[model samples]
Target: MKESDILSEALVKIKNYIAANKDQDAPIVKFRTPADLDKIIHFTVDTAGVSENEFLDLLDKYLEYSVHTGNKQFLNQLYSGFNFPAFIGEIFSTLANTSMYTYEVAPVATSIEKEMIALMNSYTGYSDGDGIFVTGGSNANLIAMFSARNRILPDSRFEGYDRKVKLKAFVNEQAHYSFDTAANVLGIGSKNVVKVKSDVTGKMIPAELEKNILETIARNEKPFFVAATCATTLLGAYDPLDEIAAICKKYKLWLHADGSFGGSLILSDQYKALMKGIERTDSFAWNPHKLMNIPLICSALLVKKRGTLQHNITDINADYIFHDIDEIEDLGKKSIQCGRKVDAVKLWFAWKYFGLKNYQKRIDNLINMAIYAAKKISDHPQLEMLVPRQSFAVCFRYVPKFKTDLNQFNLDLREQLRKSGKSIVNYGYIRKSLAIRLVITNGELLEADMDLFFKNLLDAANNLESKCQLELEIH
Candidate 1:
């Protein structure tokens, strides 16, 4: 068979996978144990290459077992659903197979990356800011911390840290684990990464942040970085950015906002207030892949100050790859990675297709859907909401009329739903209660989809109780 035939077969398989997910009767996943899946797939590579037919067969098997994240019922993580224009852009990027290092090779992609960064900066009130597409939110956060470290200790980049002075970073207790990883990557021991206290709602308390900064100073440690979370993982809580900024300003600390999960809220006129003081932040990490539904790994680290990235990460003296080009400089000068992927095209395609206004409308609809789901869970007789709805994550759990361990019951219910392939929602612990975390990141989610999830969840619970030989009495 020709190469075109192979491409056609692959596209057909992808098309079928996408269409299958839209059907309400279709399972979000074909449940498979790790051992069972290993036995089913031919994992070993032989000495000879396989034929086109065999390759197509392998592709079919891969698609058949993979979880259908495009399904509207998929609320398993921070991201779900799919964008057609972005998917096409992903295909185009793969077809080109060019590195995003220099404008000489990837002129259009470089331009797109710059324009995308400028557009994203405008939303954060960064009129003269600069940014680069990164691997993910974690790397973005790491870069933010790295920038802070270099700004204060510029000599540290060349000659290691001054052992006499202890450096410290701060983040909300509810912030993503990336901050801890960031500290470790920067060689600033993780123990020195202070965690400020937060309110019961999971928002960082400004007063506690100030107290921590003062304590760090009293201990003779240099407090240089403070990170405020736009939306946390478990509760979807947005830290008060304006207040945090004020504290950071008072301490002269570099303030970075991690909006990886809920950063797209800036597009919504109604919800943008969640990140009100984003303009004052020194750096901001936003992931279009999460809430914007662009595609995976579409994350950007936007620095308010122009040339901040280049200043922080200067390229080594390598004349071979770095050419003094006309007017435009290579993107590699500002990036940590030499051979970056063209992540901007997918985002640009999705943004162009939807436009800013339509994107806002979609985000507003998602927030409304979250509210709707929260109300449904709260009103249900057999369900109990673990926490008040914050942003998109609605925490709730099923409560049977029988005396049993609520935590274990919810765990079993989640597993049953997963194994049955009816619905694929995630679960997390809120304090001590294990709550079902229904994340509303899918822009295509509708009321009917939400209802169907509830229906499947209740049916799964009833079936589970029946199988356990325990009568579930309606409370």
Candidate 2:
């Protein structure tokens, strides 16, 4: 077969896999350690490349061992499923093989990326503001942090942090770890990233934020930034944005909304209320790969002021490559890195394919799914919720009878589900206790899926409990 035939076969296999999530026999993830995977697929280079048939065989083996993220049973991460239209656009972009940094290289892709940023900014209330797409949510937050650093202490960009001021920042205790990473990367140190107290629901308490800022100031530290989480990772809670905005305004701090996990609330009329006062933020990070259901690595950083992202104002021309043109058309300036991918095309095409109304409905449906799961968890005698449901993730724990060390037993149950290829979920300790975090990110998930999740969970618990009791009997 020709290479085209092989490509066609591979694409068809992928398309079928994307649509075959409902297949019960389909594995969520095939368990293999590093040693096992290394044995299955050797990575040593070959001077003479493998033939088309060999490549096809390798693809088959790769798919057999890979985690099926689009599978209905898969509920392990912030992004759960696939978007077909977005995937098609991604394939097109991949074939186009163009970078989006400059119009000279990829005019159409650069245009789409700018236009997509404009669309996102329109909703974000950035009047004359601008935005750029980073590789992922983490980088989006980091860029926002740098922008804040540059704008807050304008001299720091030139003189560096030496002898200027003790720069400090704030985020809720439950905010993404990217904030700590940002602080460390910016030379502010993670210790300078003051973690304000969060409420029982994992929402950052605005009053506590004010108190922390006061304490930091008392210690002669300048608090320059505050990040309000839209949906925390574990609890999926939205921090009180209105209260935080007031505090930011009083302190003259840069307010950033880390909306990577829950920013689609902007599209929903009813659900967007969770993110009320979001427009007042100085910068915002939203990941379409998450709630927007776009493909991976589509994240945007939006700034309230248009020119805040301009790091270098000196006119240094590269006439041989890029002429002085519409700066708006050339996104390479706003970006932190060169040779950026055409990440916006897939998201723009996906947004246009779904339109605003349908997308809003999808967000509403996802929120409803979380509510449904929360109700199920509440009603089930064998399950216990760790916190109130604030967004599309329901964090809970399996309650076993006789009250043995439930965390380990629950972990065993999760392993059973994994081994059986019946369902996939995640568990970790939150608030010094083990909890299962299930995010409702799959657009195709239904009440029936929730039922299946609960059923499998119950069966696993029963079996594990029986084994434990048998062990006790032997002892």
Candidate 3:
């Protein structure tokens, strides 16, 4: 069979798998220990090519063991579902197999990336700002930190880490932990990445942020940056950007909004107020791969200051590779990576098909769905809300009114549901309380599914408790 024929057959199997998953015909994954997995699938190669028939057999086993993210029951992460337009763009870019380092070879890909970044900047209220697509949210955060460091201490780009500067980066207690890694990489100690306190809702309190800044200054630490999480991971709360921006202005600090989860809310006029005063921030990072339904690893770090990233990042001197062409058009020079993937095509194609209005409706629908789920839990006698609904992520717990250990009750409940293969909602500790973090992200997930999921969850909890009691009595 031709290669295309082989792939077509595989896609058919995948489609069937997705269709049957809703009816509980397949488990999310045929999970196994590594020792067992090695016995089932021929994973390692012995430096020899295999027959095409053998290849098909190996592919079947691999697919059977793999976890299906497109399945309706999948609610494990911040992202879910397969977008058709984005799928097409991904396939086309893979087939083209071009690097986006130079315009001489990748003119179309480079231009497409530039257009997408330009769009993000425009949405961010940057008149002549700049942005770039990065590998992930972590890298995007690093770019923001790097730019801020160089901008403030202009000589730090060339100077060694020993430069007479006490550099520090601040993040709300709820912010992503990437800044700690970034600080270590930039030669600043992890201790210098100060953790500011947040409110009960997981939002950065501006007064607390200013208090930390003043304390850091008193200790002679130069506070160059502060990252405000637009939407926290577990609670889904947003920091008050309008108040935080005022602090940054007062202290001459670089304010960065890490909107990896809630940034897409900007598309919806109604929800965009969550990011009020965003335009005033020095830098912003957003991941379409999360809420916007793009493929994984599609993140953009936008800046209000034009040419700032390029100036801070670009280290030029190679005449053979980077010739003196229209330098502004050369994107690779501005980025920290040399051969960036053609990551923009998927986002651009998805945007064209969905349009701004549809994206707005999609965002609204997510929030609405999460709200509905929260209500179902609240009304049910078996479950209780842990955190109020704010974004798509609803943090709730299963409670069976007899005053049992709620934490262990939730832990066992999560495992029982996962082992049964009926659903996939992971648990976490939010504010010292165990919570089932359900993000209403799958496009196919509906109200009926939510109702059934909750029912099954309660049934599993009761069944597990009965089993435990019977074992104890017998002993």
Candidate 4:
């Protein structure tokens, strides 16, 4: 078969896959156990290459089994929905298959990344800012801590980590687990990353933070970096950045804001107050892949000071790849990676298609939908609101009429919904109760969709309760 013919066939399959995903009746995921899937799909990698017809059949099977994350019902993860322009950019970048380390190899992509960093910096209030596209939110947090470590203890980079002197960092107890991984990776010790206290709403208490700092200092330990979570993973809580910044300033510590989940709120005039003191932060981590509806792996770490990344990350001996050129800007100097993906192109394309006005509208709409979901849960007698809605995550659970284990019921209900392909919402614990975590990250999601999800959830609960009752009677 001709190359053109094969390409055309693949495109046709892609179109069909996308169309099926958008269908309201279609399942978000055709759930299957690993053993069942392994038995069904051909996983063998033979020495011989397959024919074009066989290859096309394989593509069909792949699309048939894969989870449709772009579906409207997909609310299981932080990221959901799809953007066509960004999809095109993803395809083009993959086709080019070039590294973003040098200007010569990826001139247009390099320039586009720089533009994206600048654009993100403007919202961060980093007038003289610098940034680089990283792998994910976790990687962004890791790099943030790494940058802080290098800046605070410059000797550690060259002379190696001084085990004699203990260094401590702090974050809210509700903060992402990535910080622990970061501490471990940087040799800071996971235990040294103190978990500051948070209030009922989940925001870190400034007084508690200061108390922890004082305690660490009393132990004669060096308190270097403090991370203020912009929006926590489960609760979607935003820590008080202004208050945290004041404490960090007094202690002369590097304050970094982890805005990986809620950074898109910076585009909204009304909602941006959640990160009011973002400009005061030394560094900010933003993931456009999350609420912005961009493709995955589209995250950036923006530093307030210019040239900080290059100074901290770049090696003096890598002359083979990085020539001492004054005019050209090579991104490798700023990145922790040697050969990074062109993550910015997809984000840039999405931004261009939506523009600032439409993007702001999207953010506003999603938040509104979240609020709507919260109110719906509150009004329903059967539904119990586990925690107040903060940003886009609504934590709640269904309350049955008869006496039974609420936690187990909610757990089974969530799994049943997923298995039946009715919905794909997630769950997280709110103290003792397991609340269903309905994240409103998809821009295309509507109020009606929210209603439908609740309806399906209630229906699942009814059927489950009936089956359990019948089993009990039989026993």
Candidate 5:
């Protein structure tokens, strides 16, 4: 078939699939054991030879197989459902197939990316800075840490830490795991990434941070980088960025904010206070894909120092690639990846589709939903709120009245919900205790959806309680 015909057919099929499954108010698939998966694979795949129609059918099935995370009840991971405008923009991005490196190849996309980065810098109050769109939050953090490493020890990249001094990157205990991962990838070792203690509310205690810095220095370790998490992954708490920035400035350390989850709040006037003193930081990792509801892989690493990343990572000096132009700073020179995807197009399109104020309104709605859910959970006698609602994620637990093997009960309840395929909610341990986590980052979700989720969650807990009682009686 012709490409146009194929594209039209695919779009139609996608529309049909979404329309049919959009109303599904529950999980799309139940947990399957190994034996069950073996049987399912044989019956579905082995029994029929593949054809175009069959392949499309499989596409529909597989697409809808997981918990419709984009569905109203999906509270599992950080990223939930798809945004309509961002989705459409992503389709266009794929069709364009442009690389972000060269303006000659992707002139429009390159300009859009630059403009978006400039807008983000303006939000952070960076006067003269530069940024680049990265694959995700993790990659952005890596690039930030890598740039900081190179800035502090200019010869480390080439000489492999010949300074013979232990370099340390500091982060709060409640910070996302990405900092540790970045440290490992940057060859700094996980031990060197000091975990400063966070208060009960999950904010990094500035005094503790300063003490740790002094201690590290006293131990003859080089303390040069500190990563402050704007919104923590587990509790959605924002660290005291202003105080942290003060300490960073006092020590002359490179301060980078991992605002992957909370960065979108920059658009909201009310929540922008959470990121106060962000402009003082050296670098920032922000993800529009998270709370902004843009498509995935749309994260940016903004640096206050204009050419710092270029100084660290730029190695390619081919005459053909680096021909003298009015703008000497090609984006490829600054980025870790050479042939990067044009990930900024969808975000630019999203911004265009929904104006900045409207986007902030969406963020405000999600934040309100989070607060509403926290209140609802707190009011429930059987449920206990683990963390205060800060941004969008609320951590809580279904604590039975009688504390008979509560951990086992909570774990079993979560497992039963997963097995039944009723709804998808996640449970995690905080401070060696189990708690359920609900992330309200999806802009498409409404208050009514949250009501349904809480209802189902309570029903699931009650069912698990009855089952446990029955087992106890039988025993």
Candidate 6:
């Protein structure tokens, strides 16, 4: 076939595939494992030949097989649904295929990314700031920690921390696991990550953080960075950023906020107050993909100081790259990555398509839905809530009226739900008690869907109860 014919055929197939599977709805896989990798690989690659038609067919099949999170019922993870404008922007980005390293190569993308970063800085209350797009929240966190590490100990990048300083970092126990992972990857021992205690609602205690900082200093350890979680993973709790910033200021510690899950709320009037004092922090990690409903792998690391990031990660003399530019510097000098994608375009498009007011309304809708869900769970006779809804996640479990072994019952119920493939709700243990967690960050979900979720959960529990009773009688 001619090249034009191939392109035309491919476009037609893609359009047909998307049209056919756009409205298909189903439950997400309640439990996932590599149970049939051989079959999956065969079906995905071998049976589906490399022809354009075959590839489009395979795409359609996979779309149908996967969870319809964009449907109004998906409340599984931090991210859900697709924004139409953002999707269009993503398509444009793919067609452009520009990297943000040099203006000569990606002039438009470079300017757009700089503008996007500046807008984000304004949202975080940082007037003069700089940032770079990372792969995701984890990579963003790593870059933030790396910047902090390099800022405090400039010699360690060359001499290695093994000989110069035993660097230590701190995070609240409720902070995301990525902090520990960052420390480990940065050669700062995970043991040095001081996990301070949180209150019942999961907000990190300011006094506890101060105490830990002093204790670490007393022990002759170099305490350089303190990471605060704007919204925790488990319960969506917002740490006391103002108080934490005050402490960090007093101790001269670099403060970073892991707002990857919660920073999008900066647009919401109801929840923006929770992120106060964000400007005082040295750096922040925000993921538009989480709550903004943008495509996956869109995260940013914002540093308060303009040139701090450049100081930490500047690379010069690439000969072929970094040629003289009149206006904007090459983004590569400040980014942890060398070749960066045009990930900011989607976010910029989303923000532009939905004005700030509309975006704020969307966020407010999710928060209100979360509050309503929490109340419904609390009012339910058989359900017990672990923590109140702080942002958009409600942690709760099915608790029977007369069960002394609630933990065991909850754990078994979670397993039964997982095995039954009815719905996917994760389980977590708090204060030695097991509880089911329902996260409601999906922009597409509604109160009616939450009603169905509760109904399905109860049905699953009832079925499990009957099975348990039958087993007891048989034994």
Q: Give the per-residue lDDT digits (tens) of candidate 2, residues 13-96.
A: 887776666685667778888899899996777999988888888888888888888887888888977788898899899999
Q: List candidate 3 stretches off by more than 4 Å.
A: 1-4, 14-25, 326-328, 472-475
Task: Tell me the spans in candidate 6 whose CA falls farther than 4 Å from its real position.
Answer: 1-25, 29-37, 40-49, 162-164, 401-408, 415-422
TM-scores of the models, in the order given: 0.98, 0.96, 0.95, 0.98, 0.94, 0.91
Better of 4 and 6 by TM-score: 4
Worst 10 residues of 6 by lDDT: 17-26
By TM-score, the candidates rank as 4, 1, 2, 3, 5, 6
lDDT value, residue 43 of candidate 5: 44
- For all candidates in order, the CA lDDT equals 0.90, 0.85, 0.83, 0.90, 0.82, 0.80
Off by over 4 Å in 5: 1-6, 24-26, 30-50, 326-329
Candidate with better lDDT, 4 vs 5: 4
Colliding pairs, model 3: none
Model 2 residue runs over 4 Å out of place are 312-317, 326-328
lDDT of 6 by residue, 182-228 (tens): 99999887887899999999999999999998898887888899999
How far out, in Å, is residue 457 in model 2?
1.5
Give the Å error, residue 87, model 2: 0.3
Candidate 3 residues 1-475, lDDT tens each?
8999888987887677657566645677666778998999887886887877888888878777777776667777888777778878987988898878788768888889989988888788988899888998889899899988888878778876663678988898878888898887888878899888988778888888889889989989799999989888888889999999999999999999999888888777877898999999999999999888787878989999889878986469866667657754777778888878888989988988988788778888777788888888888777778877878888888776455688998999898788777777888898678999888876556788787777778789889778767766797
Candidate 2 global lDDT:
0.85
Model 1 per-residue lDDT tens digits across residues 1-475:
9999899988888888878978878888888889999988888898897989999999988888888888898889999988899999998998899888899989999999999999999999998899999999999999999999998999888887776778999898988998999888888888889999989889999998899888989989899999999889999999999988888888789999999999989999998888899999999999999988887989999999998888877547977887876988788889999999999999999999989899899899889999999999978999898889999999999987666889998999999888788789999988888999999999988999999999999999887767565443332
